[model samples]
Target chain A: MGSLEYRCLKATGVYNVLSEALVEIRDVNFAYGHRPILKGMNLTFPKNKVIAIMGGSGCGKTTLLRLIGGSIKPTSGYVKIGGQIIHELDRAGLYAMRRKMGMLFQFGALFTDMSVYDNVAFQMREHTNLPEEIIHDLVMMKLHAVGLRGTHDLLPAELSGGMARRVALARTVALDPMLILYDEPFAGLDPISLTVVGNLIKRLNDALGATSIVVTHDVQESLKIVDYLYFVADGVIITEGTPDEIKASNKPFVQQFINGEMDGPVPFHYPGGDYQQDLKLKSIERVKNNKRKVTERYFGLDRRQKKK
Target chain B: MMAALTKNFVGLGRRVMNSLWRIGIGARFLSLILLNSGISFSRFHLTVKELFFSGVMSLIIILVAGMFVGMVLGLQGYETLKRYGSESALGSLVALSLVRELGPVLAALLFASRAGSAMTAEIGLMKATEQISAMEMMAINPIARVVAPRFWAGVFAVPLLAAMFSVMGVFGGYLVGVVLIGVDEGSFWSQMQSNVDFQHDVLNGVFKSCVFGVVVTAIALFEGYDAPPTAEGVSGATTRTVVESSLAILILDFILTALMI
Candidate 1:
């Protein structure tokens, strides 16, 4: 862990700021109807750097990613990529913004209908006038980058989960995007696959000089590659720190989450109209007169327990 | 206690309102899908083959099913009307019933059930798996890239399919009326054709089918796009798209007939 922390620190320092930051989200708020999902969220991504957004489920990490990616508009505030504002753009503008960015979905999200070659060639066919042979070679080159050469005819369903994700990653970067957004890249993967994906992400970022924003629940793997880190909860960014700083963060919620504790600042049970029932149960349990039955029923203690 | 119950009721109402509002957002997203689809027309040539395939190929099934439907309707109508000794009215009955109303409505409903459900499920799975978001990140317009092909495919396909259905249905009626029921083949077709104006009723039916196609495709795509990121959510969206789109088609057909007639 110490060596890994030192390496990450050294890597963070080596990230070139000259490549230009592709996306900068500032003080954004999002809501699913009346329920707030993100509150005054702010983030910036320098080009060619791999940043990780880590949080528990429903923490608006994905929401932040969507806002930057221009899939969803922020209810308040704005996201700017270079000089252009995302929310001010129409569909074409958004599409233009999106073209510069590539995203890797958790399950790979490869079109099950299309083969690997077609999947990688989707954007090329859509946006470019490249000849068929050139497109084919480009797809093969991308597949080769992900170590998936010669599997161009295979459908998404035919591949293993890890392989499918790799294919998706290959397809994503096939456009040679300037930015990459990875939503839970390491989630639901075995250790070997996780490292493979992690290494691939790092390699893609290095090779393409593309900025990456990874949203993940896998803290350790995410920390291994991410230069900058954002830890979010309750629809708001609670803290932003370097990987080592996040590991050393004493913030209560972050601590509780990282340590995998059941009881902490984050409540397990929802506080609802059941407060009366809770109070009633507490009162009943507090009554010493009910000890014999309470011990036998609630605690599941046998009659020999009193003797002990 | 009554006040608490009232508050709970109010809360429930608010929650319901919130849900409805979210659905409206989904609808708006679908409209955005339409706008994006319109933008996709700039790249229409590439999609022309798919449009032709999804349009021309799917017509076969509708044709076969529609012929049987017309035959069945003719057979059943003939049996019922013959008892009243008004067998001559069969031409008007079948023509009015099919060309004016049942032909387009039934075809739209069938198409919605089969193609609409599959589209909803496919896109719902994509949404649940965050593929839509992935497309957005790659600066690929999912509406342009995914939904537009389907939208235009359905838009162009449904009407053609409806026309084929009408033709096959008339032929099926001819087969039953002339061959099985001993009505002269030429006279049966002539009577049916003479009574039904292709421009007025059939064209109107085609128009309504076009509307139905849009409605079905919109509903399916909207439900799929708005689905929660869960297996159950995907399934629910698929089911809702099929049910709601079918119902919407029926309702629209009735309204259109009432207005057009």
Candidate 2:
């Protein structure tokens, strides 16, 4: 059975219309033990739309997702979902909050010991009191959604990278969560699998009427479906807009990232002194040092004279 | 000179602090295993399966080693007793030596090598691969689902295995002392029956082995859980399991033996 909101959205044909904030991250600062990651990030994810949080490697995109999920708390400020502050929740309370949230990890992260069916049925088995028959039906339905119904008996290792990811996607949305966070969902994917996963993420979000936040550096697939975009760099949201607006963004870092440019604000080369000049200086120093190193620099050895 | 002295002091402090921290965390993990045990009664199959893996898998080594050690003890005890005309008490020596010391200590050492290292590697690989993180995302505690069954398995398995080792050891000593070396079989059986008390010898050895099981299993799980999420991390955790578990078994053996005595 489809959700009433999803059915209504289908009837109205305005599926992407976002209404009200489901997640609010305010002045959130996070660090991993003395090394700062997110430096006061402020953003909102609206319900009933796909939002992309894109950044280069090590730019704290995944940290923002983890913060929202309450896996790790922020150093300062708050992450609120439906007006409840996340970090203030007790362990039981945090787990209760997390039940409503679903996340897809970078790799599939499926349990190696379990088969595909078990992986998909994990959330249902843990959280629900449904009978095995109902759970089986539900698991099948979820797997069917990702076109992996036949692969149910296969172990995670047996599946290819793409199939494992699809199983992960199916597992993520199994509970029909109110929110979904995807951490690099399109990473390490072939073009064919990429399109299938991209379409599935969008379709599932709209069908389930769930708010979706995807943290990815895969600009092409992200731009295809994400309704809103935020480009993070150096631990801050430097630019945010609709996909069209993001493409037209003139911000140097954003342009460098989204346009896939070789050099701009984020340099192609590492930050160091002039390479050619340093090499020449080193060569000259070596030449001068090499001149005095034969016999004079070593033992003042007149071993030849001693032998004579 | 001041900087060097200060650095030495800091290094010493850090070593002490790290050791204390490990002990504290390991205790907490043990408590968690106990708590999870209550909930896992419904998951009886999982616990039984782990018992088969960790406990039943260790039977071969325990049996073989126990037999060999008993044979060696019988050979040595007969030689030593020959000089003093005390060869009649060979049965008591074999039984007491095995039930008091060798059974628990050697079985535990074997368990640590075979099963404990494997547990650490399995859990560490799960961590490195983000399966733990995935379980957390699903609002499921991995410790409850993964570690608890294995923990209870080791706790129950080790003592049983130690007892089995002792029985086999005594049998092996009988094979050598009475049958091969032509000792008086009646006297050998009589002396062992009289001297080996159920409460003092067998039960203490059982208790010691149970404690060792907890310590070894706890160290293995903790190292894996606290391991950095990488290939090198899992490998390091496995190494730590072997080294730390072996050292813990020896040190704990000394303390337990001294205190129990």
Candidate 3:
């Protein structure tokens, strides 16, 4: 079969797989005090699909995650999870709604005082009557899924960044939430951890049949893991498609972002000089510098050296 | 200079009014947060520990401070009354002073400065780091889950501590009067017991501490809830919670004393 037919078949196969509109962000606009962050934002994640939202820093990606997760109410719009209006719910209603969703914070956000087992079992103990023995089994199963069962008794501070995120992921899935929200899941991770988390995200999505919405800055890794994608910049979503389509888009913002370039339609907001002056100064420096430094300055090649 | 001072006075008055308004708003928010926080066993345990630490653990310091305050009151009262040849009344004066004034007010002020600021900072950090948000996403109510235990704990713990302070202060006066100054212990104790009535003083002191406890915990939790979403915001919240709660405790002490007396 041709690629188009294969793609069509794959897309249809996912429709009704988990079979619900698990999360819907409709005409949402949010503000931090008087500063507007997200305006007229609209998005949807159907059940059983992994959707990645990629953007630069301060692009309102994480804010969108907070809005959908019901951590903050939008100033002028509404978010619905499982077709229920989240913002309108009373305290009890809101708490009940929140129980259906899980979140993996960018910083892992584990309770520093609790052990990994306690952290994962927190929601179960809070909202359910499950015996401690059963809770332990479920927590271990979730930990084993993330390959961190060996560290189940460790405190969050004892774990490295990667391991913390794994523990956080395990905790996020502890309740077997119908949906999961991942905020900057792969940012700052080493290549190995990135791949590990990426694969694990996919694995969890498949095994638990949980829909996921990932807010990230790692384009290549996100594209690999997500089934659908949205690209955001300057507090608004500019374009959205499958990973192949996003990569193939000729839009200047996407192009400049994906290619990691300086001279493009997206102008640099240099601290003390105009774009032309900055570009000229940078170009001369690039020519005189070593190829390694040049590549590092433009393409993130120095990351390897810094890691070593 | 006159014009500037007048303007400044008016500004200060308005600021005080605004502060009171915000405190009211904070109390409302605290209740809403508590209402939203669903009941859970672990959260209840955490709250109990927090209350015990904030309230009970500080009893020794409160008692020591109260004793010193009582001795100072007796010494000063004796000096003042000596001129009028009314030194014999020192027993009644010291008892009334401690049970009616020094005990609850000082203890509450101390609690606000110490525990109030710490609670505010803890909650502020939780907000800045999105841990509070994480709790919400996990179907946990941040206010009820976190603040209510501390609130009720303060409500219950502060009065008990204040009672301890009052008892210590009276004994402190007794130490100076009967043991140090050679006043007859029996006469001093009997006179104090007669002069200090429950309706007039002891119950009033407890009432004041209960109010003070509510105010301190409410102010700290309010500052925490209103903390800005950054590290600096947490620091600012801690400072404001401490300063404002202390001031509020003193001012409310005056009001409660006026109403009760």
lDDT of each: 0.80, 0.89, 0.83
Interface RMSD of each: 1.6, 0.7, 1.0
Scanning candidate 1 chain A in windows of ten residues, the lowest lDDT window is A1-10
Q: Give candidate 1 regions above 4 Å deviation.
A: A1-44, A58-60, A72-80, A83-92, A228-308, B1-34, B39-42, B45-61, B80-93, B259-261
Docking class of 1: medium
Q: What is candidate 2's lDDT per residue for A56-100, written digit by digit as tens?
A: 999999989988988889999899997899889998888898899
Best by DockQ: 2
lDDT tens digits by residue: candidate 1, A1-308: 23355346436864334335577777888899999998888776776688888888878887887777777888989999877998899977887877887888878888777898898998898789999999988999999999999788899888988888899999889889888889888877888989999999999999998888899988888878888887888877787777788888899988887888887888887668788685797788667557777678976785667579
Model 3 C-alpha lDDT per residue in residues B1-261, reported as the tens digit of each score:
999999999999999999789868986886675565454234577767877778877877888988988788777877887799777777888888877888888888888877888789888877887788889788777777777777777777778878788778877887886678766677677778788898878888889989998888888888887899888898899999888888888888878878877
DockQ of candidate 3 (2 decimals): 0.62
Docking quality (DockQ) for each candidate: 0.60, 0.72, 0.62
**TM-scores of the candidates in the order shown:** 0.77, 0.90, 0.82
Tell me the TM-score of chain B in each candidate: 0.88, 0.95, 0.86
Could you tell me the lDDT of residue B259 within candidate 3?
83
Instruction: Looking at model 3 chain A, report the run of 10 residues with the lowest lDDT sum.
Output: A1-10
**Rounded to one decimal, what is candidate 1's iRMSD?**
1.6
Cα lDDT tens digits for candidate 1, B1-261:
999999999999999999799768877876777776765577676457556655666677788888998898789878887899866556666776777777778878777777777778888888776677666666667777788777787777778778788778877876787678976556566666688787887788888888988888777777777778788998898888878987888888879988998
